[model samples]
Every structure is written in C-alpha cells, then in structure tokens.
Target: MSTEQPMAMRQIVVSSAEDIRVERVPWPDAPGEHEVLVRSRLVGICGSDTHACAGKHPFIALPYRPGHEVVGVVGAVGPGVSDLAEGDRVVLEPNLVCGKCRQCRDGRYNICRELAVFGCQSVGAMADAFVIPRDRLHRVPDGVSDELAALVEPLATPVHAVRRAGVGPGSRVAVLGAGPIGLLCLVAARAAGAEVVVVTDVLKNKLERAQRLGADAALDAAAPDLVDQARRALGGGADEGADVVLDCVSGQSSMTQAIELVDKGGTVMVVGIAAGPTTIPLHLVQDREIAVIGSLMYVHDDVRRAIELLAGGAVAAEDLVTATFPLERAAEAFAASIAPDQLKVLVSVAGPG
Candidate 1:
C-alpha cells in the first residue's frame, strides 16, 4: 500500500468573545444522505460575524464559529445527491430553513419559523471541511474567480432587497450608505435598468467608490443641502422623490433619511441590521402611503441570481474584496472587517485539494 495520509481539517473556532484560534481537527467522514462535503476555499467575514465574535449579537451566543458567506468546492457527495458531484465549485446558501414551516411552505424560507443561519445558528464554514445539505449549495458559474465567488452571498442580500422594492427599468433609486450592500444595490439597480442611482455616505472615499461603481450622484450625508442635492439628482424637485429608497445602513439616522428621501408612494427597503430598536415616523409612513419593507437574508434563488450576475459581469464582485487573510490569520481578518476603509474581508481557507 502507498504510504500517504489524509490531510487533517483545520477549523477556525471562536471559543469565546474576541478569541479565535485555528486548530487541527479530525477530517470529516463521508456525508450523510442528501448531504455534501465541501472543501472551503474562501469565507468572507460579515458584520454579523464580527458582532457575534464580540458577544454583542443577541441571538448568537459565545463559543460560535462565525462564517456564513462561504465559497467552496464539492469534495464528496452522499448517495441521495444527484445534481452535484465532486470537483464542482459552489457557494453556500447559509440560511437553513425547516421545510415543514408555514413560511417555507409559502416559499418564504428566509423567514421560516425555525430558520437558522449556517454560521450563526450552528457550525459555520470556517473549517477546511464542511458537510451540509446538498440543496444549500449553488454552483458557481465559469469565469468567476474564487475571490468573486466569496462575495456571492453579500451580493445576494442586495439582490433580494432591490427585488423586494420592485426596482425595474426607469426606476429611480437612492441608496443610503455606500457600504458593500449599498454598492451592490447600485450594481443590481443599474442591471435592472434604473434611471438614476444616487448614493449617500459620510466617507468621501466610499462615495467615490460608489461613483466609480456607476452611481449617478454621490452626495455627502452631512452636507447642508443633501436633501436638495438628492432631489435635483432624481429630477423630482422638492415634492417628488426617488421611486425607491434603500436603507442599507438601517440605523436610526439612515432610516429617517430613507423615509424623507423616498416619494409619497415609493418603497423604502431596509437591508441593514440596527444595533437596537429605534423610533420611526409612523405618521409620515401612514400619511404618505410609503411602503417600508424589511429584507432579510437571501433565499436560494437570490444566491443563483447573484452567482449569475457575478459570472455575467453585471457586478464586479472583486472590487469589494479590499483585504484577504489566510485561515491561520482569521483573527486579523475579523479585526480588519470592522475597519471603515475595508469593504469586504475574506479568509482564505483550504485549497481545492
């Protein structure tokens, strides 16, 4: 017999708040029925993962392995799996929903009663090997690099949010916060044939990036005449406003700005996660007939569309990968993720071995 040993799986486990360590763990065995074993290639660190690492997330407890935005290659498949085989590159749809729930039955699995995110709810994809249900894996099309594939999950969020707002051809959209999600929204909106795509942010660099990403107008959030500038950009004067306003920040101030910038009957899509509860102008929403919609994490369809968008060159996902770290430097990756200048931080996991 040849003298060769199998590679051990290295897992980046978060034992407690602000404590992340990479340890060599036993390699996972064969997948169960309807499950697939994935060799993680790249895992993006999300804001929620940071919050969980800091022990600030209400739902995520300590000792969590925080990794939801994951890209990997299939290594093994269970007997029940048919669509995917070994060597196929895929992106993990992190949301795990109970099929028997009412929300799942109604096709809104994002809000299933027993919904749990991959990294936040259970084990995350920060390991060299991950075994998950086959249905949660979406194939990455050809020509999409590993770095771009890592961003499919983040891009999927904005795709779902923009679609929820009914953004289509000729629609005017104003995105509050030129963060990753906001920038991706600009891409999605432009792909959807939006007439005017305006973005607002406090950071000039982010706004500049937004402009580079095809934003029609980039306005400073602290400017004295931001409202006037937004109105002029949308060609809505003072009375009319953008057809859709996306609150990618989701903080109190961003929500207020979203409500004020949208037209009377326009839709305000909330895509960001707020730290705590904040008061809203309920009277303004009711009187103006404004539809304030909340968009959670994406579904499987959004993941597929995001992959297609990245593959088709609709959005340059590589532009958001500002920093990268190896699996051994996962702590540094988490630290860099909170930096304002950093758009997306990815942890390089195991290769396609």
Candidate 2:
C-alpha cells in the first residue's frame, strides 16, 4: 500500500532580510545515476541559518531554503551506486567537491577549489526529499539513532578543526566560546588525548552545559581575571599557556584572544566567521612564530569520521540536542536556535520509514 503524502512538500524561504515564510515545493522522487534520494529525518537549525535569516550570510540568495545538518533514510539510489540501497539510515555530507582541484587531487578535498554545498551554496535539506550525488552520503551503524545521526554534520566541524590543530596527547587546548561547536571541540580534543580542555564563555547556563559535558574548567570570558583563570585552569605556570587555541566564535576580540592564548609555535584554528574587519597583531604573530589557520566546512571523510564517533560512543549526540521541533514548526525551531538558552535545535522530518 502506498502511504506517502500526496501533497507537495512545504519549504521555508527567506524573501527579504529577516523575513521567513513557508511555501509549497515539489516533492522529489528517486535520483538519477550517481545520486541518492533521501527523505530527510532531522534538519538542524544552525548559527548559519540565523545569519541567513538576518540576511547576514554572504552566500544565501533570496528565496532559498537553508537547513543543512540533515540525516535521513535512502529511499532510492542512482545507477552504479552499489554501496547504498533503499531503507539505509544515513547522514549526508553537505560538501559537493569537484574532484579535479589541486586539493582534491592531493587528497584534501575539504579545500576543493570548486565545492558544492547544501544550504549555503545550493538547495538545502529543509524539504521533504532532496537528491544529491551518492558521493556525499554516509551510512550509519545499526545502533545509531536517527536523532543522533543528524548531529554528525555539526560534530564533523569540530572533528576537522581539532584534527587541523593536531590536538592530542599532552596538549593543552583552550576553546573560546562554549557554544555547541566549542563544546564539540572539547569533546574531540579530549578524544584526541588532549591533556587539558578549558572552555570559556559569558553565559553560566552554557558553561554549566560545558561542565556536564566533561570540561576540565569552564571560565567566564567576561571575568576581570579571565586570563588568570584560563592560565590556572590550563595548569602549569601562569604563562605556560595553551599548545593550541581554538576560536569557535566569530568576533575580533575572540580572534585576538585565540592568538594571545597560545604559546610560542602553537597553532590557532579559527572555526568561526566574523562579520567585519578584525584586527590582527602582525608583529606579535611574526615574533611568536604562530600559525593561524582558518578552517572551512568539513570534508566528506570528516563527516564519515563523525558518524564513526557516534557509533563508537566517543561523543553523545543527545548531549548536544537541547531541543527539537516538528518540521511544521521550523519557524519556531529557527527562533529557538538563536535564543540565549538553547544549544542545538532540530526539525524532525521523516524517521524510521
């Protein structure tokens, strides 16, 4: 018996700055060769969505749908896709890399010259069904739940960031901003065997969540003695600072803090995007011999590793999920994502079908 909804799918589109509304869109069917048709199960509301909602994101065009942290079941597979079939629970890797770039040829596809991405650059996962090349889909292990599966995308960001910074044994890592990405960074750094994981933020509720997630210390970044707190919480002498500093927030001050907090020869990973020009101390960077690197969206392999982490129990997706909404209430979901108290907000689409 056919039980699918006969009506077309509903999608939220941004018509103008700060204006979002629901509109009807076609329901996608099975994809062509080298593609996959996924019935999205959960679509995460992200900070990028908030920026797009405000017309702040650089890549969002008018009247485009923008939810991309998606997990779903494979409803159909294109020709030559022997790796996946109908009824497989999976997570989609939003990056669509052109495999011919220098980075792609050299096995660094994350930095591919011509990368196609969902939500920000192309059609997003906020609809009932969407199609993409089979190269982006990752199969989850049997035990991983769909709720947790949706988080692989966000989780992959930190995993890639931490990997870029080489966070591992005996490393003292400080994560700026205790948002979901920061918290996820802490988790990844710890899993990489970092000796210290210190997360800082101005909000107590968020700091509390960080503590609950196994942070060694959660300091208030607004504290008058924040540097002292960070230095102490990081262990060793007052000036023996972090080996790696991760700035998960996109502000000029936070960028400065990221550079200042790391010790000589240490690496700084900027995972967040700032809205405007941010000053950097050129002389300090030169004298300190520090490496400042900006990390972009994760590669497909990182997404796969994120799924592996979920399956292996290295990080718990449930911990990051602060709230959820049905797909019909996507507006409310987006609103809650920007609220001061929420961590990760998700919209349920289709599950176990």
Judge candidate 1 against the unseen true structure and give its global Cα lDDT, from 0 to 1. 0.86
Off by over 4 Å in 1: 1-8, 15-17, 351-353
Q: TM-score of model 1 relative to the true fold?
A: 0.95
TM-score of 2: 0.95
Model 1 Cα displacement at 302 (Å)?
A: 1.3
For model 2, how many clashes? 0
Cα lDDT tens digits, model 1, 1-353, are 12132567688888654689987777787899999988888999887887788877777888887778888888888988999988899999989988998899988999999989999989888988789999898898888898988879998998999888999999999999988888999998887789999999999889999999989899999887787789899987778898999888888988888888899999999888877797789999999999998999888888888888888887666578899899999988988988888988999985523
Candidate 2, position 337, lDDT: 88
| Residue lDDT tens for model 2, 1-353 | 12364457877676654466667887776588899888888889877778777777776666668767998888888888999978898887887788987999998887888876787778788877788888888887899988788778888999999988899899999999988889888888988899999999999999998998888999998887776788888995787778999998868878777777888888889887667678888887899999988888787667877888878887677688889988777778888888898989998875322
Model 2, poorest ten-residue lDDT window?
1-10
* Alpha-carbon deviation at 134 in model 1, angstroms: 0.5
The lDDT leader among the candidates is 1
